[model samples]
Target: MAALLGPVITPEGPLTGQLAGDPFHPDTKHAAKALAQVVEALLRAVIGWLYRLALLWVMVDIVSFPHDDRPAALT
Candidate 1:
């Protein structure tokens, strides 16, 4: 979504230079804001995936127990 709606275009109007100033000439402030938002979303996704993976690992560990006739240690 960000890739498609990135690089904020400045209209040929009065607030062109002042409002859309880019020191590096790489991206306007609006585009930078969009890029920052994209980065934040990516971070959130990564964290969410990590949490899900941890839960899956825990479930796997619990289910992979040695379910033999013998019992657990008493001590």
Candidate 2:
């Protein structure tokens, strides 16, 4: 995906052809880097929430189980 959008985002790419600017423009690179950081942070938060929810479910299951010393009588 990056390979395909890399050119389109760069200064010399078709998207910015009218500007006729350098391909390695600083502003463009900075924008992409910032976007990546935001995405990474969001993903980390989602994964952490999911992990906590799963842990809570396991704990509830463990607490709800009966701990009996005697076996059940025949029905």
Candidate 3:
């Protein structure tokens, strides 16, 4: 498995990169973890948008014709 160590040294302050991993065979666990994290973030954003959409629907009022229409004023 390749682990990223906190910035030790770099031209620009510090940078993160693969620290160490098997030279012959690498592990897929870390890759899977990274993928899951990205997917979770995306899902969170989508859910948030859906929640806002539902709230907006509730906030906006809708009136139907014939049922909610006003009658003519008396002379």
Candidate 4:
């Protein structure tokens, strides 16, 4: 699902470009753009997947065994 959706969503806007205001130096600009593209795509895909599955956040409780606490097993 991410594979398909990532490309579709990321390319909708121009990603192979300079930063919003602070442009990268000429030599590093291309690399920066590529890295930004990858990060954006991955973030979009992950967020989309989590949102679609209705798994934004589920409650979790941590429990410890050996409540007596006689120095843990390793001890």
The most accurate candidate by lDDT is 2
- For model 1, residues 1-75, the per-residue Cα lDDT tens digits are 534665546464333444446455445656778889999999999999999999999999989976675556742
| 8-69 per-residue lDDT for model 4 (tens digits) | 22434533333323465453687788899999999999999988666434322223333576
Write one digit per residue (lDDT tens) for candidate 2, span 1-75: 645555465444555543435546676677779999999999999999999999999999999987675666732
Model 1 spans > 4 angstroms off: 1-21, 24-27, 67-75
Clashing pairs for predicted structure model 1, backbone only: none
Clashing pairs in 2: none
TM-score of 3: 0.47
Model 1, C-alpha of 59: deviation from truth (Å): 0.5
If scored against the real structure, what TM-score would every candidate get? 0.55, 0.62, 0.47, 0.39
Question: lDDT per model, in order?
Answer: 0.71, 0.74, 0.62, 0.59
User: Which residue runs does candidate 4 get wrong by more than 4 Å?
Assistant: 1-24, 55-75
lDDT of 3 at 3: 36
**Deviation in angstroms for 51 in model 1?**
0.7
lDDT of 3 by residue, 1-75 (tens): 323444556444443344323333233466767789999999999999999998877666433224545657732
Error of 3 at 66 (Å): 12
Inter-residue clash pairs, candidate 4: none
What is the TM-score ranking, best to worst? 2, 1, 3, 4
